[model samples]
Target: MRRAYSVETVRAAEAALMQRLPEGELMRRAAAGLAVACGDLLRRNGRVYGSRVLLLVGSGDNGGDALYAGARLARRGAGVRALLLAPDRAHPGGLAALLAAGGQVVDGPDGLGVLDLVVDGITGIGGRGGLREDATGLLHTVTRDRTPVLSVDLPSGVEADTGEVHGDAVRADATVTFGTYKPGLLIDPAAEHAGALRLVDIGLGPELPEPPDLEALQYADVAALLPAPGPESDKYRRGVVGVVAGSERYPGAAVLAVAGALHGGAGAVRYVGPGADAVIARYPEALVHAGPPSEAGRVQAWVVGPGLGDGRGAEAAVADVLAADVPVLVDADGLRLLDAETVRTRTAPTVLTPHAGEAAALLGTAREEVEAGRLAAVRELAARYRATVLLKGSTTLVAEARDTPVRVNPTGTSWLATAGSGDVLSGLTGSLLAAGLAPRDAASVGAYLHGLAARHGSDGAPVSAQDVAEGIRAAWRDVRAG
Candidate 1:
């Protein structure tokens, strides 16, 4: 698992580590890593010796890292220049070191003629809101030529804890983070601003605490969590998933949801809705029913609300599914009918999958607010409903009601923004729940597989929901192979 610590935690860890090391030793270690990363980028263009490097120095340690790194490049024969945003506030020691190494300080933007690369050290993790007007204007002028940018620690102007980008922010071609990943570098909105991420260990692991603020699962982690059949395993032993979806108006949703469930690790899929005939046509293996979910017979888990439109029957169906003692997943139209008290009172584990719009309605806020602050929105929903919440979008986040690390999915692609795609995810996660995985694990694993499947199905082209379901087997194979 890839762990991300909050700014407070990282600061504490850095402080603790700095105490044990000699004076300026910690900063030297960080500068060494930054210099190597800068050299690598310069090498790709030609060589570091003749590269024109520019540093955006601010009034913080981040600026110190940049200044020291500039000195390293200068000693290596690179023409390095520092554009100090705050001359008086700049790291005095670092500025002196850069000048001693033959690096010059440019008075203003006009002196920044041409550059091979730009190092963004305008703000650190502690800086919030966005870039100041002066920094923003200077950044705009520098980036007008489309010079590749390398942001130190993280892209300035993005919240390190919440991944929210307010006002003006630096968009970097790549970000060189230290010690560990930040929540802003992993989550979206802010994540999008960070093109590529590179982590440099400054040996803060021993100082940091267990159970980081956020985590992202890798291939090996997902492989171990995946379910496989044994020689003595039977259909019932594997698990059965019940899907209650689709209305007369949206029968295709039922078929798509069943498609995802069939591909999931479930032994059998039992579907109950008005779209029974359509599901039967697509998948004869699914057990179909036309009445309420109560009459749908035995199921280890239930997935409700894919295409059930607004109606009296739909409401009753959602209520009936919630009453079941099995693990339940609620999505789409079902999200609209959920009662916070009812969900909180459930004895069985409940998972809520909502997009930004749906999540906003549940939280009584605007969609834009949820989109801006996804980490907060997802955590709030999980706490309020007392259930596992999956906030789906550019980055799929799974948060448990308890104080555990939130899982951020890294495999998501833009191709997943299609009709019925979310319905497929709902059914897939529901199947995992039936397979006896905990709500949080099921949600995380489901998102991982869902994203990989979408990539396989799309493969640089447009893909339908059915194509994504078909790609599940391939995704499973790939994960196992690794």
Candidate 2:
């Protein structure tokens, strides 16, 4: 798992580490690491000698890292030039080091056409908004599509904590972050600006807190979380998912949801909706029920609201599921029926899956606000609803209530944006809930598997929701093999 800390937490850790060390000791360690990363990049481009490197230096410590790294590069025969955004306020020690090493402070992008690498140090973690006027001009004057740029700490202009990129931000080939990974480096749209990332340890880990602010699961982590069948496991012993989905108009949603549940490690799926005929026709293995979910026999968990329209029956289904003692996953149309009373009053664990539009509706805010500030929006929804929330977008984020870390899904692709895809995700998550994983774990694991399955189904081409559901088995095999 890749853990990310907030800017405040990072600052606290850095402060604690710095207090026990000599003056400028932390900066030197950071600079040395930065120099090594630059050296590797220079080596990849051919050699450090005769290579032209551009350093966009500002007034902060970030600029100090770049200027010092440039000095080290210059000593090895690379032609390094610094373009200071704030010439009067530049790091005095770093600038002196650069000049002593035979590097020059340039008026403009002198070798912009022939530069091999660009180092962005215009803004640090504490910097706010977008690039300053001078920095913006410098960035626009020299940067090209093929340039290999490395950002110091984080790409300048990205919000270090929230991952919100307002106005213009530097787009880098790689980001060399110190101490720990910031939330922005691991999330989009700021994460999109940060390409490859390199962590430079300055011994701040021991000073940091135990739990991270956010986390992204990798293969090993997901593999460990996956539910496995044991020797004594039987149909009833495994888990049963009760699905309340589909209306007369959207019968395909019922079929798609059941299809996802079939591969979610569940023994059986009990589906109760008006689309019983369509579901039974598509999946004969499903235990179909035409009555209300209150009378749908036994089930470990329930997944309500896929294509069910805004009607009295849909309301009853949602109410019944929420009233159950077992865990519940609410998605699609179910989100529309949710109120502060219904959501917060439930004693059982509740997981709400909403796309940006649905989330905006639930929050009584605009969709643009939710999209622009996804982390804040998701976190707020989880707290407000008093339930775990899976905000589906370019990046799928699962935010839980309390002090737990937010789960940022790294496996999702644009191909999973097809119609009914969310419905599939709902069933899979619901089944995982029935399988006894915590609400948070169930949502994260289900999202991981669902996204992986979509990638397999897509294979670089457009894929339908059915293709994604069919591809879940292959994804499962790959996970087990890994």
Candidate 3:
């Protein structure tokens, strides 16, 4: 697991580490790592001898890191210029060092010549809301050209703890983070701006909190979490997932849901809905039940509502599944039928998977609000519904109602916005729940696999729902291989 600390936690850890180190040692380590990365970029661009590098300097230690890095690059033959946004507030030691090494300060870059790369040091962990006026103007100047930018610490103006962009934030070509990752670097609104991330170890020890406040599971972590069939395992012993979805109007949903469940490592899929004929036509292996959810029979877990209508029938179906006292995944229209009180009253674990629109409806807020602050929205949904909520989008967030840490899924691709994708995810997650993974694990693992499958199915082209389902086995193998 890759842990992300809250800004307060990072500051606390940094303060503790600072006490043990020699004067300026931590800053030196950060500056040295940053200078090396800049050197690599220069080498790749074929201009290590005399490339033009511009640094946007601010008031905090973030600016200190950038100035020292500029000094190193200047000594190494790179023409470095530092744009001081807060001239009076600039790091005095850093400025003097850079000047001694042949670096000059510009008030702010206005009509300045294009540089090969721009480094953002406008804000760090202590910043809140948007960029300062001077910083925002400087960022606009760089955006006028194709000059690639590397953000120091994090992209300026983003909420370090929640990944929320308050106003204008710098969009970087890459971000160089010090010590451990901040929550903003891994979650979205901020994550969309922070292009690629490179961590520079500043030697902050494990005295930082355990189990992390937030995490993004890397391939190895996910690989370890996946269930492997034992020598004594049989089909029945693996697990069975029961699905209640579809109506006569949207029969294809039931078929697609069953298709996804079949590939989700579940031994069997029991379907209960009016679309049994359609499901049987597409996937004959499913055990179809045309009757009610109560009589559909035993299952380790249940998935309710993909294309379920907004009538009494949908509500009744969801109530029946909730009554089953098994792990349940509710998605799409099913999300609309949920009652907060009913969900809280349930004895079994419940998982809610809602896209921005669905989540907006559930929270009685505008969709834009939910998209702008995904972490807050997901947490609110989890608390209100008393369930594990998966807020799906570019960065999928899994938040549990209980005290467990939230896990942000970072493997998103634009191609995943295709129709019927949610149904597939619902099926896959429900199957994982049935296979005995906890609600949070089921949602996170399902999201990881869903994104990987999209990448495999798209191969840089358009892909349909069936293609995503068909690509699951390959995705499973690829994850396992990792």
RMSD of candidates 1 onward, in order: 1.1, 1.7, 1.4
lDDT of 2 by residue, 1-482 (tens): 88899888988888888899999999999999998998899899888899989999989798998999999999999999999888999999999999999999987875556788899988878788988776777787777546788999999999999899888899988899998899998778888888888999899989989799999888888889888879998776678999999998898989899989987778899999988898888889899998688898899999999998886678878887888888999999988875568779888999999999999999999999998899999999999989999999888999987879998998888899899999999999988888889999999989999999999999888999998998888888888888
Question: What 10-residue stretch in candidate 2 is worst by lDDT?
Answer: 138-147
Off by over 4 Å in 1: none
**Tens digit per residue, CA lDDT, model 3, 1-482:** 77898888888888899899898888999999999888887788787668989999889799999999999999998888999888899999889989999998886676568788898888877789998776777788776777888889899899899999988899988888999899999888899899888889999856588868899987887787777678987766777899999987777788778888888888899999988888888888899887578798889999998999875588889888888878989998888887778888888999999999999999999999999889889999999999999999999999998877899996777888888888888898888888888888889998999889888988889988878887778889999988
Candidate 3's displacement at residue 309, Å, is 1.3
Worst 10 residues of 3 by lDDT: 106-115
Q: Residue 301 in model 1: shift from native, Å?
A: 0.5
lDDT of 1 at 410: 93
The better candidate by TM-score, 1 or 3, is: 1
Off by over 4 Å in 3: none
Tens digit per residue, CA lDDT, model 1, 71-172:
999999999999999899999989999999999998887966778999999997878899999899999898888999999999999999989999889999
Q: After superposition, how far is residue 229 of candidate 1 from its true place, in Å?
A: 1.3
Give me the runs in candidate 2 sitting further than 4 Å from their true place.
43-46
Ranking by lDDT: 1, 2, 3
Candidate 1: TM-score?
Answer: 0.98
